[model samples]
Target: MRSPHWKRRLRVVAEFVLLYGALLGADWLVTGGSGFVTLSPNPYGLPILVMALAYGTEAGLVAAMLSTAVWLSHGEQVAPTGDYLERLLGLSLTPLMWFVMATAIGEVTNIRTRSLRRLRRDRQAAAGDAARLDRAYQDLVDANRALQVRLAIDTASPGRVIALAAAAISAPIDQRRTALRDLLTAATRTDDFTCYRVEPDQTARVWLRGTAAGARPVVLPKAFVHQLDRAADPLSVTTAEDRPLLADIGVAAAALRGADGTIMGCLVIHRTGFATMGSHSSAELAEIATWLPQVLDLGAQPVAPAASRAGRG
Candidate 1:
């Protein structure tokens, strides 16, 4: 296969030959076969100028050289009819003009083309930056909203905290998990998390899951579950030793305990921004986890059978 560079070179050569040959044919016809390259206007210059403007300096130069070759091919008819020095000057004039014009026009065309491409590249870069800023602005808006929610809980008295928990528990059974997830998102300041419902067989099932954009879904590693069950408090990974144990599970996890103190479920936080993962948020997460089991327990209640509509029929 031929390279694109060679193909382009071949195409430029073909265009120069065809256009120059056509100009020669027209000049020959106009001069009644007196020959080409001998006319006052020197029609051969047109091909060089056209090629230069169309394909830049190299193409124009090639066309000029081709024109010179045509002049030589025409022999005495196109040759100078004068003394030695006069003949030498005449021979040089047409080729010089063609080369000069081709160089100037081709350089100008190249400069204009380069400027347009640079403008296009600048426009594309500006567009990309604007899109990124828009996304960052949206993230700031969400964080501000979550901060408001977190602050509301943080500044509340014991009575207010109890009231909020009561309100969540009183929500419909279907809406309970969603409320819990949203509450966690506000408290944690990050949406990348998972909630699990522990089955009777000691296996954890995905009761609810939430993840930020570009984040993978959280999967609770078995070792992480084992660690949560054994540890009385929430587990925070702050050392390399614990990292592998919680790999793919989350950065921290708290076991949801029932009134009897048996582990009923678990909440795993996969990621939270460094600014929000301090002692304050950690305490808030544990505090929220305490009441979460109460809300989770409500889901265990069996739903009443739908009322029969047979009477209407």
Candidate 2:
């Protein structure tokens, strides 16, 4: 409405055309399309209301003024010569009253429209703020969880396996499995753990902690390898429905990868909650997986996270 002055000008012109056309039709009816029209049942009334609703009070006032002129001009042509003055003077108040009514209604309509628009704008702003607050609240919860995990890990050791895993991120390719074995052994609560090496030909080789060559060349189920092959991100499955393969060896796992994030293998953990772990064991394990990926992408030495205790706030 504010921009492009030409459009507003065009609207003003169109409003006037409609007002005058209606006034002419009304005049034709009163005058029988011959003499002149009487100023009863003002045709400008509808036009004035329309202009008010569309473009506000200023538009309505202009329309009212134009109607008043047409009415006065027609009154002269239609009235009888003698004693016409009295009749004209008697009906003089009609135009003034119509103008007043138009102005009053226009202002009222404009005011209500503005109020409704303002209400809508205010509601939209409030919704936007609510969305931001909700997002911030979630972020706060995650931060608090991370803080709790770090605090627990700092208080008591999760064993040398965790420490070695932390160090192994910077270690050479072959040694990462060695460090992972220690961590998964402590974490899985089982001694018969086997690390799998998925090959390019959809085949896999299983390795124990100290064993180099395998007596049993275990071919992974095609369905399981296909699923793991599709996974590009670290996944920890606890629920039964998550993976078809976890039903065989792993109940929950953190997928392992090479320095380039290629799916090398998985550090298979046991069920959701079965480690020689602290109270917040799930959060601690998550923290371990997040901070120590297959290979860390950092230029600086990793500092111990979250020393101070986090609060409910």
Candidate 3:
């Protein structure tokens, strides 16, 4: 029905012929060859409407012209006997009315088709944009995963090599201890190092200090625990107005945080000239600060600060 084929052409011809025949037969019955009234419906307009939708404006106009001829012929039989030109004009009015109506309907159908075609084009364009964005997002995810595979995390200190190796393995208490020491060694120029765990009871226990103070945990003062828990970054305080315990130790301090960002412990590196250990020292302290809690969680408690050749200065 939709194709530009012989069958389509045949369908149009058949419809026009049938519409003309039906109108003529209806005219004969309604007028009965003695009436002057048009009681029969103008059904030919329906066939013109169908052609406009099926085969477009050109086909509809053709149907309208043929139907108009049939309408004019029927009017001649029913219309009054009068002057030739006046009767001719009166008979032509039926065809003229039907032709104008069919043309108007065809124009409206053309407008509706154009709107539908434009809507389909817009939808396709939006779908294409969405697909492109999905492809770009997938590419970024794959690149990040590749970069993570190529990277290795290790300390800068030479003394910490065995500790890093030990921590890399699982199931050994000595390995855990070595890894914890590596946390101090990774920071910089260690003269002495200590690890303190923040207990649930709001007290701090110095788990290990220097090279060998391990018989019992040293419980810190209440004032020290209050200041330690609130610390946001690594510090080296030489002032009494702040944490005097850290000032007394003469070491730079950093917080050990878990994966979820909770501060679990503290590391104090006793390097000389602590007050002036400045930005470079602070960055080194912060870098090692990230690893201490992971080693601690693996049963690695700080043992002793081993002697080293490298100094942060």
Q: Pick the candidate with the highest TM-score.
A: 1
Candidate 3 lDDT tens digits, 42-125:
566667777777666777788778777556656656466889888878777666766676677777788887887788888889
Q: After superposition, how far is residue 80 of candidate 1 from its true place, in Å?
A: 4.6
Error of 2 at 35 (Å): 9.3
Off by over 4 Å in 3: 1-37, 53-56, 144-313
Q: Which segments of candidate 1 are over 4 A away from where they belong?
A: 1-7, 32-35, 141-277, 281-313
Model 2 CA lDDT for position 29: 72
Better model by TM-score: candidate 2 vs candidate 3: 2
- Per-residue lDDT value at 134 in model 2: 99
Candidate 1 global CA lDDT score: 0.69
List model 2 lDDT by residue over 143-211, tens digit each: 999988876664234655566666666567677666555555454444444556556665555644323
Candidate achieving the largest lDDT:
1
Could you report the Cα RMSD, in angstroms, for every candidate shown?
A: 16.3, 16.6, 14.5
Model 2: colliding residue pairs: none
Candidate 1, residue 109: how far the Cα is off, in Å = 1.9
**Count of backbone collisions in candidate 2:** 0
Local error of candidate 1 at residue 223 (angstroms): 33
